[model samples]
Target: MQMLMYQECIDACFDCMVACNSCYDACLKEDDVKMMADCIRTDRECADICALAIKAMQSNSPFAKQICALCAEICEACGEECQKHSHHDHCRRCAEACFRCAEVCRRMAA
Candidate 1:
């Protein structure tokens, strides 16, 4: 069978979700957890959106493009938040994944 359309975006979504979860957990473990509250919230939001976007893309939902667009926006927001504390290895890694995911999602939405 031919490869599905938007496969790259779907894969990126999954990868970003995993990275977001890892970053969220790491943020919780930090000594200054309060500083990471926004990051933690956004990470979870980004992860959830990425998961839903993958489902929409997989089934070729009419809203797949819309989902991808939203996912890209959320990824950007989460990535920016992660970038604020690049000293944390987990945050840095998550920021990279989110940026990559955002790029693919925008392409798929186009």
Candidate 2:
């Protein structure tokens, strides 16, 4: 059961990474990219953190739980930031993905 939970968490991390990357790329294409600067930065940070959390979990490290907890927080913040621009379809989708990933990470952390 623990192993299965780890796998699910890893999957969620990957999904969040993809979503973050996509959102970042889309943001760069916007006419006013400066407006999304913070969102872009958060997306990159969240993606990196999620990937690190997945690696830690896969290694069965004792710190994995703590890393996952941090990852969940970052993911939630990123999601909220992304949701601010619901006018963009990509941002909306990315926010949803981040929210889902955060929930999964929270469960795994616990």
Kindly list the per-residue Cα lDDT of model 1 for residues 30-101, writing each as its tens digit.
999999999999999999999999889877789999999999999999999999999999999999999999
Candidate 2 lDDT score at position 20: 96
Tens-digit per-residue lDDT, 42-108, candidate 2: 9999999988998898888899999999999999999999999979998998899899999998998
Candidate that scores best on TM-score: 1
Residue clash pairs of candidate 2? none
Estimate candidate 1's RMSD in Å.
1.2
What candidate 2 gets wrong by more than 4 Å, as runs, is none
Error of 1 at 21 (Å): 0.5
TM-scores of the candidates in the order shown: 0.96, 0.95
Model 2 worst lDDT run, 10 consecutive residues: 1-10
RMSD of each: 1.2, 1.1
True lDDT of residue 62, candidate 1: 90
lDDT of 1 at 17: 100
